[model samples]
Target: MNFGTKAVHAGVTPDPSTGAIMTPIYQTSTYVQESPAKHKGYAYARGANPTRNALQKSIAALEDGKFGICFSSGMGATDAVIKLLAPGDEVITSNDLYGGSYRMFRKIYEKFGIKFHFIDLTDVNNITPFLNEKTKLLWLETPSNPLMRITDIKALTTIAKKNNMLVAVDNTFASPYLQNPLALGADIVMHSVTKYLEWP
Candidate 1:
């Protein structure tokens, strides 16, 4: 299917109950079961929410990724990624960082001992000097927030792969319609889904 068609239909299953074309929100905080362990996939809101699942699946498909994870906010998603690293781990990212991302790194994670190196990532080779044994992830933001600097995701991911590091691209600026970092060798793609995700 084309991008437009995929955007409209990917990950959307016909509603089993009402036959609605789009996935309906499963809004309840709790689900009842016949027994303690026997029930539909959902058990609680905190663990699994069908509405969130549908949205996540949709975004994943849109980004050409196999699976997707959603968060309460963009910062929550970034926090989850940061939590995957240990105290001595390092991250190399664009100097034109998003405000929320900067806060997460400087105010929150830095105190925990994770070091961050922010540099001009416009030229992929510029990252070579910053690469080191402690590096765990390369966080890139294309069409970066505020200033809108575009980083080459494919080039950066290639270098990251050689060093055995994970590459995550903040796709909030381009959105899935404009670019897909997963298809370009990025391990993870993030979208804020707050500004450009228009709803009918």
Candidate 2:
């Protein structure tokens, strides 16, 4: 199906029990087990919930990716990605990243031996010198923070691919409607849905 049609019909269906036209929130903590090893799809709420799974599937479909993992907050998503880097791994990132992300990388992750070198990503040449075998990730935030500077996603992705580094973009500013980083060759794209997708 087309993008517009997929957006409307991708991750939702009428409620079977209530016959409602929207996906019902499954607000339970646990599901009944038919036997010790045999049971239904859901086991625990923390691991997965029907409503959250629907949203995850919807987002994965929208991004045209195979997997989508939802977290409690944007920071939670960032933390999950950072876990992929082992101790002593190095990351080359934009200096104009979100304040919270900068703090997390500089203060918290640094204690575990993950080194972050903040560079002016606007000058793509500056990033090339920093790439090495130990560089595990390249973090970007286009239209960065309060500056609103646009980095050429294609250019950066090319450099990252050449260096054998994983590229991650914080897409909160652009959202999926404006930009799809995965389609542009980024390994990961993140967003703070609380800022735009939620009701005030």
Candidate 3:
């Protein structure tokens, strides 16, 4: 399907009761249930909401990813990816990426015992020396936050995959319209929806 079509219908379904074409924003703390543990797929507002689910589904479809997760902020999404690692696990990331990401990784996750290597990832070879058994993930942000450094997604993913590491890309700057990192072999693609997306 074309991008325009996927953008509209990928994760969306007509409202069952109202038959509204677009996904509705369900504004409530808790959903009504038929019985104990028997709700319409939504239990708590913080846990899951129909609107957020639809958005996540649409973004995932656009990125060609199998699954999607929505978070409160870009840092929240970054935190989720970091949580995938163990205490001693290492991540090699682009030095030119977002400052908030660097703060989250160094200030927050570092205290948790996760190691990070912030290096210039403009050329794929610059990352070679950082590879090791402790390196569990490859983090990237391209058309990087302020620097506009473009890392070759396919080349990086290829190397990371060869070493059995997961590759994650922050596609906020590029957005799904410009690039699909998942299609380029990235294990995960993250976006700061507050920017390009109006639904924050």
lDDT of 1: 0.88
Which 10-residue window in model 2 sums to the lowest lDDT?
A: 191-200
Backbone clash total, candidate 3: 0
Say which candidate scores most in lDDT: 3
Candidate 1 residue spans exceeding 4 A from truth:
197-200
Which scores higher on TM-score, 1 or 2?
A: 1
Give a tens-digit lDDT track for model 3, residues 97-156: 799999888889999999999999998999999999999999999999898999999999
When 1 and 3 are scored with lDDT, the better candidate is 3
Give lDDT tens digits, candidate 2, residues 24-93: 8889998878987465677889987878987887777777777788898999999999999999999998
Error of 1 at 76 (Å): 1.1
Sorted on lDDT, highest at the top, how do the candidates line up?
3, 1, 2
lDDT, candidates in the order shown? 0.88, 0.86, 0.90
Q: Encode model 1's per-residue lDDT on 64-183: one tens digit a residue.
A: 999999998888888988898999999999899889999899899999999999999998889999888999999999899889999889988999999999999999988888888998
* TM-score of every prediction relative to native: 0.95, 0.92, 0.94
Say which candidate scores most in TM-score.
1
lDDT of 1 at 191: 76
